[model samples]
Target: MSDVFDYIVVGGGSGGAVMAGRLSEDAGTRVCLLEAGGRGDHPLVRTPMGTVALLRTRLHNWGFETVPQAGLNGRRGYQPRGKGLGGSSAINAMIYVRGHRSDYDGWAAMGATGWSWDEVLPYFKLSEHNERLQGPLHGQGGPLWVADSRTGNPLHQRFMQAAQQAGFALNDDFNGERMEGLGAYQLTQKNGERWSAARAYLLPHIGRRPNLQVHTGAQVLRVLFEARRAVGVELLQGGHRRQLRARREVLLCAGALQTPQLLMLSGIGPQAELARLGLPVLQHLPGVGRNLHDHPDFVFAYELPTLDAVGFTLGGGLRMAREAWHYLRQRRGMLTSNFAECGGFVSSRPGLVAPDLQLHFLVALMEDHGRRLHRAHGVSCHVCLLRPHSRGTLTLRSADPLAAPLIDPAFLSDPRDLDDLVAGFKLTRRLMQAPAMAAGVRREVFTAGIETDEQIRAVLRARTDTVYHPVGTCRMGRDDGAVVDPHLRVRGVHGLRVVDASVMPAVVSGNTNAPTIMIAEKAVDLILGRSRAHGASMPAPVGAGADVPA
Candidate 1:
């Protein structure tokens, strides 16, 4: 309640909200959470399909875009970051995935001594409350809700049928023991409303917790350090600069893009880059904004008659009125759908550890993101490199916190990554033209007309874009190039922790919201000296210069 608190968390996004909620549980500990954006009060943000309305809502979103990527023939990649209480989780498609077990095990093997699949699984299980069956892999009483798809488009069922006919086994659970098949995806929703991190964790506790203070519309300018120790945070509050002290630690949950930018603003990054920003270098950690990765997808669409009651486009105006009646009267209809409906996981090539490509089936057939209406009735199949090989960086463009950081996703930068993408496109095409999809589909619109590899490559070169999953900016590692240690603590900086997607050592093979939440959940256990009884494996301290898992 005072100027100084036990913990000062920066950014009230997916991870920060979880940390603030969990760590503030102790009556003796005081927590302060600062969010740059306004409260998530926008009506669109709360609606089940509010992302469309929120996409162009700049007041509630950062809406950053990447620099012209040479790999994409000098095209700028669009980025939609949530600028509200829930952060991107509020605007995301709401898919829930824990990534592969080997993802964490590899962290342990990389010098992050205690992190393994076995250790992290408990934390994952502990954070989720699956609406359906509860088992060893799932926990029932968790704060976060993982609900099954309440409604499915007819096209979704057909996509599965096509996958089944194409020889890939059908899998109803991508987060189960096996993640290498096609099936319906579980979303982070309850009924038809999105249960974002802020809504599930922070909101319920804010009213009753006296020790926790959440400050919205507060932009952190820098982390205050004394003798290389993070002691507090300096922020702009209500047009007035206010300095808030943190007695124990300053946690950075500013997401992947902005966390490193904040650190650099406080003089913790490449010496040359810092010097260019006119900042006094506190530490020369070159990896502060490096190792950025994401999943880039290329979409395929086919024209449909738009007559089926169970398919998309049927939810427009007249149908919307009918659906509104159903939802208002009984809470049923297309209003419950996430729209990017059902999808599956598949391997782009053989000999890989897990599925390398993820497919998203959508009934809407717009060729580009946030674009004009489709010329005709249609649906689309989006498939791309699940875990791309290309890497990029985000660097400070100016010393001012208001200045946007320079983002370079470098999509399809690697020739190998492009090759994998081409393979993925080929496979998706096979599924679309198969008997299952052909049953009621009239004709192909987007790529249905393309027959050769050259034509398909042209489509990808012009339109392949990100699936909105970005990670690895502040990678955890034993190497000097890594920005953070295995426990998500920043290297060369004491009492400062990076608690978001930024600390991911590598990009998970799917949507990032779930893993980001898992990171925060596991970090809470570590801070409390507790480990999840099931999936969270905590490691002992490793040498600073040795390998570490984050």
Candidate 2:
């Protein structure tokens, strides 16, 4: 193993895995990937139903919690970040969504040059190997494998039918011409097993490419800088402090929360904050942690007397045991369920350009991110405001790199966000109460009998938290407040770049995993200075227009 490489990628998460894999494709270049967690090869990580165990336990999760949120009546929010080779992708629901076309176009409009829908669609196609869908919108032979969920639970179809019964259209493909309506989600899986970013990009090529080095349980303390240029990284591995140099560049792909925390810890944050923490300032970038935001979500749960929902009763336990055996033999059954198997995008009101709220109809009674479980068979539907108006900040609680950062998403700080969520709640309740869904429902369990707008607002304040899509901390744009520029390079530094979800100027309208992977795919070209003409290019979706203000 070499101490120095052409590219040193920090945090072997979604983007870092892609970076290491793509950069090392050039046999001439050497790449090193650092991960804070273990190899993430546990059977729990490969099983879709294992998501519950992963989130509940600290095995592969960072298990971060936010400061008490004023918007949620001073309740601390739970944030479970993935720790290991694949990062959050290894622990996520496996839903493969690329957000709406407007999301990328809006980025270009906001001065993130060369990131329009037409410009970025190629990267999305390049990263995906969709088994069911094909054509210009999807790729066939790609690293990331995406397939329809293999869960045979009839409740998934019932949720879709219920949405349609409530006057919503049934959309077969949310990633197609339209992102509006109800349907089953395409998952990042192959043969009923979870297919994470590491699985797609790094694992297959590990020993085959000697130039690519992946080190797990290597925690990066800070980026080492010579004056204003990032030269290497200081990390702790095997109870020993060590340093690794980057011959060309040091890429930070540590996702939203940790990326900003890393920058601040390395003295590249607000001058006052750094000085107060008794840390010398390397470069003052206030936006390193200023634009923090996530989709504030509320879940409506109901108890049902049916075996279709996952539970812990005697019958349910026996059924799960049988399903486990079935999964071992056929690789399909209840164990193949990604709990939130079916969902959709829809608007709370008419005349909206795109859906303002996204729904995840789960086949279990989920509350507090499934942390607090119910002993009965039930179902849950999550409604989240897609594009929130409120913004928050991430600051260091202490100079200690191991200390959790001060996460304040300030959810619903803007009055309009609350209003939008109220509308979304009413719409979700209507779908849950529709004839198709009502037939399976024994009774409403959470937020039941809440009809008034004020009551709904109260419920939101009490229950709303993150739906796991956190971005925009290290914003990318051509503005004074932007932390990274259009090319994802740090504003006041050289030989350094952030190629992850943190660089998003605004949160996308859907799941962020696929979009983050796309960012890495496009970043490979930028880092290598390759032209779009040489990469996979496709015509823009018909009727897709210029960017609009988000």
Candidate 3:
């Protein structure tokens, strides 16, 4: 096998898949994508309902657990990251949310140049091929497929109705003119199957594109640098250590957790941390793994007698069999459900600049990310703090590259986060009590009989965990502490860049997968030195000023 390539992409996750696909489109650029897990072609990955199987097993999941969080009564949080070709997209719920426009605008405001809503919207449109909604805000003929849920579950509409009855507006499109109302989510699916990043971008052109090489089960150990410039990567592939040289660049797309870990392992982190670990420091960038944050989420679970809700019971088992038959025959059934099918963005309090909390109404009772199962029919409402002030760290537990990094999200460490969550809990409780939902509700299970601010605070402290959108470790900004600059080039280094969720300056207002994909779409232009006509005509400087809300 050839040892040299024009570009070496680490981690075949959302960002790496996009990078490998787009860069290799030139035909001249040889791109090598290394994935730590298998090809991710299992049936459990393709079937939408199979997310349950994938989440329950460690086959294709990293399944990393965090250090006991002081904010959550010293309880550890579960983090299930996809380890295969498609990464988390393969195992994720397939909800397609681009987050609020204000999210990107805020990034630009924080000195992440060329990342404002106006500047990055083109990229969002560029990567999307929406099967239903299309116009200025969306695009057609793109690689990624975006479609509405085909499940046609009554519970989805019920959730929307409940939210509206509770006074929230009905929004047909969250990615359109407004993002503040409840609605059914679009999904990254095609023909009732999960169309993960690999399916959308990499898998199609695998054998077709000779310049593109994909290696599964190749775990990158470290970036090999010459003086200051990254030149290659050392990886353990097929039980043998292999060195592959990158003639041009090494792109780290290992998502939030591992990207920073890889950087720190490669001697590109805080000097003191490296010294304490007795590792040689290649570059002392203090921001390598700092500014770690995620949406602190709490689920309000309930039990119901209605069979309309999904659960594990004799009746539910029969329903699943029928749904399976329906899926196999027509590709439309409850099996197509993403579970968190309907949700919305809202403020915890009135008249906020933007929504500080987001809701994800589920068709089934989800406790501990579906890890805990109940035998009765039920439902759940997930409320998460959109912009958490609490921050944490990702540090090496040991010098071993194979060991999991120490993840401390410090959820609710900021007292304000607990306050926001309390307000959100009250709002969600009101929504759940709406006529549409109250009709089917039997009893509240999680925070039952909980009332008053102190009671809510106690519930939040016990239940608050990640909504799976972790970012900002290798933050992009113009500040010296920033690990990557506005262009995503690693600070104090050349021929190296971070192109993933880890580069987000702050967590977005909603689901993060869509925004991460958009980052890669825009990153292609930045890497190739090509100016996007859609973005180039904008009047604002990339990071000059804050965007005034219209």
Candidate 4:
């Protein structure tokens, strides 16, 4: 590997992969990407349904956990992060939603400069190769492949019918026009398999560019700095630890959780917290782990008389067994389906401008993957109160570099979050009871048939978990204690930047993968001295709009 490069990107996840590929495009600059996990050589990751193979596997995932949530009946939530090349994008459900325009507008209203809808459209368009969007809002010439899932299940149709029965218009596209109805999800897939960032962005440029180097299984321990300016990284590679320099810049794309952990480990975080950890304060960045937030998701399930060909269910084992046999023989049947085949988005109440909540329709029933929900005969329509009102956080439990940090996304810490979720549950229940699904869909089998709001709240507290999208740990802004600047430069430190989801001042209303990629693309432009058009024709971010601030 080259001793120095024009830029060093850490973490070969979704954003990191894209950044490395995009930044190395000109060939005028050399770039090296480092990942804590191994190469993207696994066969399971290539399949759409192969997420199950990588979900719990250490080969491509870091199974982290949060401290007990005070709002969720004191239950701890399970956090799953991608450990390999593509990061969580390699293990995600692959749903591709760009989120709402207001989400961007809200960012502009906040202090996050140039992140308004108008300003962000180019970046989204740049990362997207859309099949339908043929306009100014979206572009077709991009590396990331965006298309509908090839395989469609009839159960999904029935679910959509149910959603319509609940009075939601059949939205053909959530990423287009308005994002306030139920529809089939567009995925980040090409051909028939999962199109991971590593496959789409990294691997294509790995061997062709000699200046670009990729080092996998290289765990970064901390950022090396001199008088607060980050100059290099200390890493553990091949069983031995070493320090590597970045002649120009060191980028952190290690994601929300690890990015904060690394920052705190490197002595950059809240002063009091660092004092407790007995670490010297390299930088008194209070926001290193503050404003930690995530969407707390809940699943409502049903038991159907007829079994599905490809829904995730424990009781459907016999049918899945037959389906698995068929898949092995001809690559067909239920085994080939991703459990979340169809879904919808809508406002929980009437008269809302955009969708306040997002729902995912499913043919199979899913219990808690966090602590394992009991398998029963049914289907589930998962609904997440995406535009949550609550915010929690991530902080270092100990200073040990090898130890996992204490993450408490104080799930539903705010009462408003509960109210919104309750409204969503009522809407979801209405959808489930719709005439469209009356024949195929069954009764609500999961919630113990509870009726009262208090009971519903109790159930939600017990069942609500993360949809796995976490951001805003290492927030970017012009604030005094912010970890990174608007250009993604680390505060109080030069030659270093955190370029992952953690930099989002706030979480986007939709899934975070796309926004994270957009951040990387925009960050590259900033590093290359190109105009990002930030603060141009856009408003600033809002009140602790303290959301995907980056």
Q: Flag regions of model 4 displaced more than 4 Å.
A: 56-59, 307-336, 370-377, 440-443, 531-550
Over 4 Å off in model 2, which ranges? 532-550
Candidate 2: C-alpha lDDT:
0.89
How much lDDT does each candidate structure score?
Answer: 0.81, 0.89, 0.88, 0.77
Tens digits of lDDT, candidate 1, 1-550: 3699999999999999999999998989999999998777565666666665566547588989898988877889888898878888888888888787777887778766456788777778888999985778887888889988766456667778888888888888888889888878888887677888898789888769999999998999999999888999999988999899998889999999999999999989899999976899998999999998888888877677663322334445566677767766654556666656678788988999988898887766655564456545667778968778899999877787899999998898888888888899888888887798877677676665676777767778888888888888998877888888877788887788899998887787888998888889988876665565544444454543332332
Q: Give per-model TM-scores.
A: 0.94, 0.96, 0.96, 0.92
Question: Which model is ahead, 3 or 4, in terms of TM-score?
Answer: 3
Residue 474 local lDDT, model 1: 90
The candidate that wins on lDDT is 2
Error of 1 at 250 (Å): 0.4
Task: Put down candidate 2 lDDT per residue, 420-522, tens digits, no spaces.
Answer: 9999998999999898899857778878789999999999999999999999999988777889877788877777889999999999999999999999988
Candidate 4 residue-wise lDDT, 184-251, digit = tens:
88877776567778887888878898778899989889888886566788888899988877778888
| lDDT for position 100 in model 3 | 82
Candidate 3, which segments miss by more than 4 Å at Cα?
532-550
Which residue pairs collide, candidate 2? none
